[model samples]
Target: MTVDPFAKGGLHQAEAILKAHGVDAYFRSMAARTGDSHAVIDGRKVMLAGSNDYLGLSTHPAVIEAAVNAARRLGTSAGGSRALSGTLDLHGELEERIAAFLGQEAAVVTTTGFQANLALSALLGRSDIAFLDARVHASLLEAARLGWGRVRRYRHLDTAHLRELLAAAPDDAGRLVVTDGMFSMDGDVADLRALRDAADDFGAKLIVDAAHDMGVLGNRGAGLAEHCEVEDGLDLITATFSKAFASIGGVLAGPAGNVHYLRSNARSILFSAALPPASAAAALAALTVVETEPERRTRTLDLAEGLHNGLRTLGFDTRPSTTPIVPVRFADLAAGGAFWAALFRAGVFTNLVAAPAIPGGGAMLRLTLTANHDETHLATVLEAFDTAGRRLGVPRGPDLPPVRLTRGDGRRAGRR
Candidate 1:
């Protein structure tokens, strides 16, 4: 009775499992869509709450035109690795632009965020001990494993635990502490100040993956390291252009020597083809937008406040967060699934997070707010949440006061 892995019943197992958990999830086939607040999902125009276009620059005319122009000039693809034949002037230009914007000495753009982390780890992690945050993005964890490093994980954002680990390691041991600037699922900023201090005290290098914080934080979208005034303390910073940049590529920024060293050592970058000409151009344009349009940051901050305030008022436990990523927590998976479906019917779409993504018995509805969202759309989304909460029989509670960002006191300052 050797059954094929591709058998009909076997193929349907995933669906059945989802149904059992009261989640009728499907990979939606989206039709033509814009990058603004609205998008076409399976022929229905829905207000986009899941997109990472925090600055709404993906469809900007300037960005679009830059991509078109680059494609016309440099063709569609780089065709080879940068070491071989893929290195184009456009690549260098983009790297330099990104480095300047982030106040780094040098930079390298890779195929994706995963690849960037992989490259960094493969190049720098061989003999080093990597101290990772438990809730860090999977890419960094994978990179550490691929690098064959001695990886130790600390509790999420727990600097005390990290300090204990650092204290135990030998002073001569090469230590690298890595974490996500803003936890994607919980939308909470990392305690960069504490991490930096720990790294300095332990004589370790600090690396931050600001994939979600870039272009969504800081006065000029410089990310959490800069927002925390630890830019000088950070030894390396890796981020993706896909989020707020509205392009497809990952960037590694640090000392010029390190960037130069990675170019020849990282297998991921040495073998894979370079980013397309258009994508590089689009990232440059998006960076420009993030620089010139500070209002986008203000508006998005307001939207995040509104959503956080509204969700708490509806009696959902949104784990302590101070960014655009808002997670509405549920006691069980069943309720989380039902709430998601009900919210969809109410004309809102959000990510349903469970199990491994969120460590615990509970689940979450991860909602992201973008600068493209207006008051009208925000109101609609809030109403949908209200309806879903009622349908799910979640108790309503008094609105908790909003978490305000202060100038210095080291809590929730300047976006990150």
Candidate 2:
């Protein structure tokens, strides 16, 4: 069918495409919540298995009290950009605490994770060559675009390919190699060790977006860099507070001078309002949770094991996931949508990933686990998956051996 170019049905066309592709997203409002375990969505208590709340501090008394107290003391908003009057005491304290937690010399908090990448890339990426992993977050890609850098994408988690690109790029140009410490969708940790080696060989500074790694990996949830023994190897580490920190902001942790440079040169930070008092305070409190609660990390891995093993035993193709996020593989969009819908009807909520998120035939259900999920919660999530799997007629276990879930840096070399 031929369609008009300037018609009044752009919205209709978009909706048609969504329907054609079986993208029926449910818009349920959540009213109450607690940790990674459970929440009240649409007035019904649903096990929240898909949150990045790795440490389950989202509803912790300390985090909640910190936010509440901060709002009471400083009001709701910062009202100005960080460059202006928005650089409040709370932001300063959070930055200091976060930097210390991540083993960095300094940190700068931004309005969101996207802003953190946008600002840092803008500052550090002059006429440099940026070698990014193919699956790196969109924020980093956007930042590269804004930074006006020579952007080259290496195969996802392929260190040798990245090395070739870095070697071929002009050595005289500033060099920044960016990757996600833990890939968001697939829930697989990056090959930071290999990436670091390549970066060092080529003299390219390494930047890790640890949004999924923070508060989930490492001895004290310091992130993939610390877990992979590359905390110092990386030149910069950026993460989002909205995930494990349970707040609405992002922070860039690295050398004090680089952060200072970002503060001065990054337009995103200069133009956007700083993170509000409540978010800053909550993030500060969350850092305490990360430091004190080692069991949260343990529980996170345990829960991940339960769900990963459960689904695998039921015969669904869950990809190699050592982290809390697992992608249940489907041959195409049809099966993915059917599985997603079945899971929803079975009273479990998971992120449905399809085209644009995955390769054309690589559609899958992205299941995210949290440390807060107890056996009961995980069982419920698995039961839903089993139901969905049966309906979709997808084969259960693979011919390959069972993938064991382990702790301490889920990186198996060349396994990506």
Candidate 3:
């Protein structure tokens, strides 16, 4: 592969790689979205099984009104970074509310979920060790490399491996055990209990990026840490508003001292423009709804659970996932692409997770559910997947785990 994107030599190789895997159904334009569960893609209305709008607050009347009011009053862009003149009353309001909701002593808002992790650079010392799960999000891995720290990986979901890695690190070194609260691809949650215990044993802090867990888990919709009853055991938590808040922004919450330090020292926050007023207002309103409407999260998980079981009964290898994010595995990338194409043709839309997105160079279909989805939608989607499975001759097998990328092999981190 060439080092340049515009170099002529790289063009054919890039096209050939994508074309060989039948990767044409992705990145299509969509118009006239009705709600969280339906959208018009390519001039056709389809059931959206690929969306992350778990609570369906994107279409909530209150959220829309708040955004409209904020945009009308403050204009669109923040106009500058938060360290300068971009900070608004709306930012403080949202930050305070989020901090309280997450049970953190303080919080700082960022422009995107990626930046939230990048902000960790301000806290990691050169003598620190960041122990990560092999399947942790790419943002965390990149942050560890770019920040002042040494990175080490353990087997995904294998607490024993994490403990071993921690035990082998320098005793006097600062340590941080990092993981995604709910994995975006596999849709399973980390064992927070195990993580907390391991970190405590090694005198390490716990950093959880609950991008997929916030507003969708726990009795109060806090996240996996709360759902697993380990919230008080963790040191830091980060989350995004894009998924359930129906807005765009990121938040980093922790002790008051750490948050204040990052707010002052993090390059990502100091250089990047603050989150727009409309986005912040929308997240604030969505948070209110998320607090009042617990049934939405319940409906989302119910739909996902039913869909997971239905796919399994149809002989598809859907990992036992209890979250709104469900993954259906396939024999290979070609099969996954063909199935995704077939589903689109059948008026269903889904996301494809192909190598090096996951290990073994195969593909996985990421099926998500939202509060707006109903039993009717779930039944229709299951039928489409069942039809596609029989038609493509994939996802039909005994349950098994895929072989994973070896430690420190960053290719499996998903460039896609």
lDDT of each: 0.81, 0.79, 0.83
* Candidate 1 lDDT trough over 10 residues, lowest sum: 405-414
Which prediction has the highest lDDT against the true structure?
3
**Model 1, runs deviating above 4 Å:** 1-15, 20-23, 123-126, 395-399, 405-416
Candidate 3 on 1-416: residue-level lDDT in tens? Answer: 55865765432443355578675755578787886578887789999888989889999999999999999999998999999999999999999999999988999999999999998877678888899899888888888888888999999989999989998998778998999988888877788888898888889999999999999887788887776777677788989999999999999998898789889998999999999999999999999999999888778877876777777677776664546677888776667778888998899899977765676667788998789999999999999988877777773757544322111111131100
| Candidate 1 backbone collisions, by pair | none
Rank candidates by TM-score, best first: 1, 3, 2
> Model 1 over residues 1-416: C-alpha lDDT tens digits?
99876765432453465589766745766676666667677577777787777778888889999999999998999888888889888888889999988889999999888889888676544567899999999899888888766889999889999999999986567888999998888888898999988999989888899999898777677887778787767788999999999899999999988888887799889889898899999999998898888788778877877777776766665656778888887777677778877877766778777766778767678887788888888888889988877766875555565555312222356432
Separately for all candidates shown, the number of backbone clashes (residues 3 or more apart, or on different chains) is 0, 2, 0
Q: Which ten residues in a row have the lowest lDDT in candidate 3?
A: 407-416
lDDT of 2 by residue, 254-358 (tens): 988888888788888889988999999999998898888778778878777777777777776567676778888776556666777677667677776665556
Which candidate, 1 or 2, has the higher lDDT? 1
Off by over 4 Å in 2: 1-23, 34-36, 123-126, 409-416
RMSD of each: 3.3, 3.2, 6.1
Q: What TM-score, over all chains together, does every model reach? A: 0.92, 0.91, 0.91
